[model samples]
Target: MIPDADPSADQAPALAEQAPLTERGARTRARILAAAREVFEERGYPETRVAHITRHARVAYGSFYTYFPSKEAVFLEVADLLFQTMIQLDLVPSDGYEPATLIRRANRAYYASYRRNAKMMAIIEQVATFNVAFQEMRRKHRAGAVARSAKAIERWQRAGLVDTALDAEMAARALAAMVDHSLYLWFVQGDDVPDTERLLDTLDTLTLRALGLRP
Candidate 1:
């Protein structure tokens, strides 16, 4: 018979004691975030204030500060949450797919999220110009995003789909620039997005060819 497992091995009485408080903190944070989104969407980032968020959240100003230091901090947290929400949608391509297939999936993921979170997306665009801190935050976020894309391109090269000689970082940055510009154009087009599927397919072709992959 197997020896009895040690009872203390999995025991975390300290954590058990703190679990409720941790959960409550998370709930309070979520409430503030929800309130912030509404406040920002309604008043625009420049006009929105921390007091508005606290009032909307039905929490005291001190409670709001206890959870987040400032309105900008809360907005950044919203940005972080939006990024995480998109990640949970599995925008990243799987290793099993060819580069083109991966590109299609990634594009679809972006377009879908862009539509679903249009309000937050608009706020993001506004803040990128309206807030200096948000601009820096976006820069850092883009760097990380591009780094991941570069690694993915390197993986594709190893898989024999992309040219091994192409500089992964350069290709990734170019692709990021291209996708970003395209999204800007799409945003300008608004509800009149004609032939979106064709657009994404064309983007895949263009990006793949840019990476020295045959279309």
Candidate 2:
């Protein structure tokens, strides 16, 4: 069965789980999901309907219900797929690396990925504004990254690289917020963004400075 919203909110209504699908059934389900993503991208969430998804998939209307109970169920899976792409980018080994190099690499990776997925990212941001489940999922995803960064900072402190007196979690969250919202403004809010290399360089410098390191 496909995962609908990998990290679901407690208050969110659950979709009914389907039984294991055969190969052909799986292919059909995948087609429906792909169609749903296209519909969502073309029309945004509020304007998309189950009929639109099935019509785009070129499947009978009943085929949509056979796999997904509703448009929201399918959209949740689409959102989770987008979230997974982001998770793969930031979770990496940090040991035995220079802070400046790692910071630059991270900013470059994040900025490039955001640029590629800006359209879908914009849609997700819009969804999060009104959808509690989407909001919770976004929050949990950021929290996981912040927690990972805090662990890395703690390791840096042990090596006498970063300030030992600072609260690692708090410091990590501050840096995360700085990067996250700045990217949001440029990528989603139509703010003026510098050239790619210049933007990444500034992000790298600012992140290093925040961590009390020379850029």
Candidate 3:
């Protein structure tokens, strides 16, 4: 008799478990995931299937099931990986750097990452609109980033570097919304892409001024 399939395998592995994959297992998983991203980007989440991913990956159909129990599991894994990469972006200042400079650097880095993953991001947004699981995943990702930003804003306020009157959490959420919405419009909606340097400069200036930072 055939063994029963793992029930938990239908869910993406927890973050801590993701790292302990054996070398061969990791390679196979990566192949499946890369295939998933490409298929999703080209055909979108609604049209994608496990067979498409397996064919694109050039792995046996059974191999795909061994790594990811379903297309949804793999898709969530891909989104989580992308979110983790973005979360690791840093704005920490060096010894002589000013806050404004650090903010500019952070924005530049963020935009660069966004550009690299623009297609996947567009897919994520589209899927999240109607998929409850994907929507919750998106919400959790944004909330974590906003919470970090709010804490940073609070620190800046205590140091007298930011406006004392602004509510830290609200300010953080607003700024995050501004960046996310602008990127979505420009990158995902086929709006004309602005010059990189000018765009960064404008964003940095607006962010600093919003926090009541003076030149």
Q: TM-scores, in order shown?
A: 0.80, 0.86, 0.86
Candidate 2 C-alpha lDDT tens digits along 1-215: 00111122232222335699999999999999888888888899999988888999999999998888778778877886666566455423555557676777677677777777787888898898898867776676676667667877787778898889989889888887787788889888988875767776777777777778755
**Which residue pairs collide, candidate 2?**
none
Best by TM-score: 3
Whole-structure CA lDDT of model 1 = 0.69
Give candidate 1 misplaced runs (Cα > 4 Å).
Answer: 1-22, 87-93, 188-192
In model 3, pairs of residues that clash are none
**Number of the candidate with higher lDDT, 2 or 3:** 3
Give Cα-based local distance difference scores for all models: 0.69, 0.73, 0.76
Give a tens-digit lDDT track for model 1, residues 1-215. 00001211221111112233477788887899899999888888889988899899988889987777778888987886675554333434363445566676776777677668777778788788778776776776566566667877787788787789889888877877776667666773464557888778877878877877665
Model 1 vs. true fold: TM: 0.80
Clashes of each: 0, 0, 0
lDDT (10s digit) by residue, model 3, range 67-156: 777888899888988886765564444335566766776787788889889999999988888878777777777776776677667767
How would the candidate models be sorted by TM-score, starting from the highest? 3, 2, 1
